[model samples]
Target chain A: MESLLERYRNLVVLLAILVAQIVGLAVQVRRTSAGVNTLDSSDASGVRLIRLWANTVVSPPERLIHSGFGLFAGAWTNYIDLRHVRAQNRDLKQTVDRLRLEEAALLEDARQGQRLEALLGFQEKYIYTTVAAQVYGTSGSDRSHVFYIDKGARDGLKPDMAVITPDGIVGKVRDVFSHTAQVLAVNDTSSGAGVILESTRIRGILRGDVSGRLEVVGILADERIHPGEKVLTAGGDLIFPRGLPVGVVEKVVRDPDRDAFIDVMVRPAAHLERLDEVLVITSTEPRFSPQQQQDLSVSAAEEESVPAAVKDQMKASEIMAEKLPGLIDPNLAPDQQPLHDSSNPNPVVQPPQPLHPDRFSPGSAPDDVPEPDAGSPPDAQPRKPSALPSANGGSTLPGSNSTPEATPQRNL
Target chain B: MALLGADLRRDLEIHRYPLLVYTLVPLTALVLQAWLPRVVGRYDWFDLPLVITIYFALGRRSPIQGTLMGAAMGLFEDALSHNAIGINGIAKTVVGFLAASVGIRIDVENTTVRILLTLGLSLFSSALYLFVNRFLLDLATEWSWLTELLRAVGNALIAVVLFPLLDRLQSRD
Candidate 1:
C-alpha cells in the first residue's frame, strides 16, 4: 500500500486530463443552452487556432497532416456543388424556351385576324376569321406535322382546305373532326400546290420537292422569267388567290433550250418544323365545263383566265345572319356553322353558283384514315370512338348540301 | 524562488506536460477533418489519433489514473466531434477505469494476454459507446456492424502493439 502511494504521484497526468475535460464540458453546456452547437463550432475554432499555433511550434508532420485533410474535404464539397449547378442550369434553359414559345403563340393569334383584314383590302370584309393554333410536338415515327390549333375543327374547318402561316403557304387539311384538324405541312413530300411568280407572271406547278424546297416548273419555257423574283398565287383557276406569297428564287439553273419548259426551284415561305396557325384557304373554284376548258388559252388550273366580272352584291338579310350566328347554312357557307350541326338553313340552294352535289361532296371520310398519330399533338390521339362517335363521325363533310327542307330546325 | 526552481526541474526531468498537444491537438483535428471525405484512398484505423491515446492512457497506474487519462482523450474527441462534449468524456473515463481495474488484478505482464485484453476492451468500449449514443441519446452512426467491428479490431491491434512501449516510457519518466 505504501508502494502504491508512491505510484499515485504519477496520477498528476490523469488529474490534468480530467480538469481539461471538465473545462470542455462546461463550455459546451453554456453554448448548448444558447441554442448553439458548441461541440461543433467551438471545437472547430479551437482546432484551427491550435493547428496554426502547432505549425509554428510543433512538428511539421502534424501541420501537414491537418492541411492535407482540409483540402481533400473542401475538394469533395466543390464537386457536389458543381453537379447541382449543372442540373439547375439545364432546368432553367428549358423554362426559358417554353416561355418564348408561349409568347410567339399569343402574338401569332393576334396577327391572323389582322392579316386577313389586310389581304381583303377592305375593313373586315372577309369576316369569319380563324383562331390561332401552335404546333406543340412532332412525331418522328410517323413523320406527321399534326399541329394543335387554339380553334378546333369546330371553327369551320374542312378537309382539303389550305393551311398557311403568315410566313406563307403551309398545307391543306388532310382530315377534320369535331375539335381538331390534321394539316399536312408544306414539307410532307406528298404535297403539290399551284404557284406563280409575281415578277414574271410565270405560272408553274409548285411541287414540294425531295430537297425540302419548292420546284416551280412552267410548261412554256418561252415565258421570260428571272431568279430573285417573288412568286404569288395566280388565282384565276381559283386554287389559291392571286398575290399570296409562295417563295423567292434560291438558285436558277437555266437549261439550254430543251422542251418548251422553264424549270426553277422555289424555297417554301413556311418553316414546316416550327409551324404555328396557318391560313386555311376558302375554296373559290368555279364549276367549269369541258367546252369551257377547250376555249381557254391555258389548261392549267392555276393560270389566270379572263373572267367576265359580275357585280357581286350581298343582301342586308345575308349580312344580318352573318352578324347573328347560326342563321346561314354551314354546308353552303362553310364559315357560319357552329360545331354541333352548324344548323345552317337551305345551304343547298344558297350559293349563287351551286356545285353538282355528286361532283362536290366526297360523301363520308374513310374510318381507316389512321388518326394522324398523336406523336404530334394531344389532339391527334389515335381514333378512340367511344364517346359521341356517331354524332361526330362524317356528319358534316365539306360541300355537304344541307337542303334545309329535310334538316331539323336548330336554334340559331 | 527555490520552490519554483524545484518545480521546473521536476517538469523538465519528466518532460511530462505537453499542454498544446493534449488540449489543442484533438480540437485542431476536429475542425480540419471532414466528417465524410472521399473514400478513394485507404483509411488505416491504426493511424487514428484516438487509438494512439488509448494505447498510452490505458497503461496508467490505477483505475483513477486511467479514468483521468480517458477524460483528456474524451475532451479532445468532444471538441472535434459535433456531439455532446461530456458524452465521450464520461464514456471513455468509465471504459478506462474498467480496463485498468481488470488489468491490475490479472497477469497483465504477459504480452499475449495484454494484447487479447486490449483487443476485447476496445471492442466492448466501442459497442458500449455506440449503444449509449443510439439508444439513449438518439444519435446517428452509419456503416454496417461488420465494418464497425473491423474498425474496432484495427484500433485494438494498434493499441495492443504500442501499449508496452508507451508503458515503458511512462515508467522511465
Candidate 2:
C-alpha cells in the first residue's frame, strides 16, 4: 500500500507537468491559429492603441523597470565610460559602418529606380516614410527569436509588418495586443527572403534557420556565386522591397557531385544580437531619386508645387505596396491565404521563387523549385518548426550550431 | 476578500502537505528579501516569479507538492506578467521539479544544517535555472557568482530561522 501510494504520488507530479505542457502547447496552437485567421495589418494597429493606453496607465511601474534596466546598463557602461575615447570610437565605428551601408543602399536604390523607370518608361516616383519603435523587452528564452516592442496596434503596427533595426531587417510582427507585440527575427528557422547575389546577378532564396545562419539557394548552373559577396533583396514580388541590404556571402562551397548545387553562407547585414533602434519603412521604394546634379534645382522648385492630396494618395499606395500585403490580393478572405488570388507572376516563371517553404501549401514545392531570378537562399540541409519538423527527430544536430532544420509546425 | 483568516488557514493547510514546510519557509524569506520589492515594478530584469518558484518549490520534502504548487504559482505569475499565456507556468513547473528532485537534495532539519543546506540548494538551483532559462532559451540572463551567492545565503538564513516558528504554529494547532 505504501509503495503504491508512493508510485501514485510520482504519477500525480508527472501528471501536473503533463497537464501544464498540454495547456501550454494548446495556447501556442490557438494563438497561431488566431494569427493565421486575422488580418495582420488591422491587428497591428489595434495592438498599438492598446499599447498606448497601457503605457500611460503603467507609466510609473514601467519607468521604474526601465530605469532599473538603464541603471544596470549604466553600471556596466560606467566602467567602459572611463575609457571615453574607446566608447566614442566604438560608437563612431558603428556609425561609420552604418553611414557606409546607407550610402551603398541609397546608391543601389537610385540605380534600381533608374532601371525600373527606364524599363517601364514611367516617371520615377518614390515615397519614403518610417515608423520608429523602441524595443522594450525580449523573450530571452524564446528559441523562436521573438522580441517585445513598446509600439502596439494603436501605434500603427500590425502582425506581418516588417521590423528593422538601424542596421537592417530585424523581424516581422508575430502577435500584438493593445500596447505591445512579439516580433519574430529573421534569424529564426522560418524566415525566407528573396535575395540576389551582388557580384553575380544570380538570384536565390535566403533562408534563416536555427543556427543564426543564412544560406542561398536556386543558383542556375551557369551562374557562379562566390563567398564574401554581398546579398540583397531583389525586391522580387515586393514581399520585401528591393534594395534592402540582406547580408554578405561568407563561404561558397562547391559540391564534388556533378549536378549538386553550390553552398553559399551569408553573414546578415544587421547585427541582430545587439540591436537598438530600427526603421519601419512606411512605403515601398524611396520617394526621392538620387537628386541628379542637373535636376536638383528643378526638382527642388517643383517639390513645393505638388499638391498635398497627390502626396497623400501616393503615400496610401506606397504604404500599401510596402506595408500591407492586402493590395497584392484584395479578394481573398484574409486568414485564408490560399483563398486569396495572389498572382503567380508567370505560369512558367524561371527560377527564384522565395515563397515560404510549406509542403502543406496546396502545391507542395513546384516541379523545378523555381530558380530565383536574383538573390536566392540556399536549400538548407533541413530545419525546424517552419520547414521540416522531422529533422528535429533525425540526424545529429550540427554541434555548436543546433539551428532547427525547417520546423513546419511548432506545438505552441 | 477570501477572508484573510480563511486564506491563512488555507495557507496553513497548504504548508502541511508532506514536505511543504521546508519549501514555504525558504520561499517566504527569499520573496521578502529579494523578489517582493521587484513585484511593484513592471518588467524588471530579474524574473521574480521564476525566482519565487525556484527558491521555494524545490526545497520541499515532497517533490510532488513542490512541483504542483510551483506550477500554480507559475500560472498566476504568467497572468500577472501578461506573458504569452502558459510560457511562464510551463517553464516554472519544469524548473520546480528539476530543482526539487534531481536538484540539490538535502536533509538538514537542524537550524545551522538547514541554513547551509538552503544556501547550497539555492546556489545550485539558481545555476540550474540559469542553464535552462538562459543558456538553452537564449534569453537575456545575468549569471553572476555574487548574485547567486547572495540570494542563496539570504534564502537559507530565512529558512533556518522561519521553519521553527512554522513548526511551533503547527504544534499549537
Off by over 4 Å in 2: A1-127, A221-223, A254-259, A285-412, B1-173
Candidate 1 residue lDDT tens string, B1-173:
12224334333433233455445534443333323223433563432444544443434325665676566556555544456665666567656666655544444556676666666666666675676455544445674666556766776676566555454444343
> How many pairs of residues collide in each model?
6, 62
C-alpha positional error of residue B96 in candidate 1 after TM-score superposition, expressed in Å = 27
- Residues A1-412, candidate 2, lDDT per residue (tens digit)? 9888776885576576857554543433322343332112222343345445534434555465567767977987887566787878899999999999999999978975654444233222324455666567877864667778777777777777777643456677788788877777777777767777664556777776567677776565543455666787777735566766788888875634545676577888887776554545545545555565448778767877889899797788666554443343333444544323456846885656547754434444342133332343444333333332335674432221222322222211
Candidate 1: true contacts recovered, fraction = 0.23
Worst lDDT run of 10 residues, candidate 2 chain A, spans A403-412
The CA lDDT of each predicted structure is 0.54, 0.56
Candidate 1 Cα misplacement greater than 4 A, ranges? A1-128, A134-153, A182-192, A210-212, A222-224, A253-258, A281-412, B1-173
Compute the lDDT of residue A63 as modeled in candidate 1.
Answer: 55
iRMSD per prediction, in order: 6.8, 8.4
lDDT for model 1 comes to 0.54
- All candidates: DockQ: 0.13, 0.06
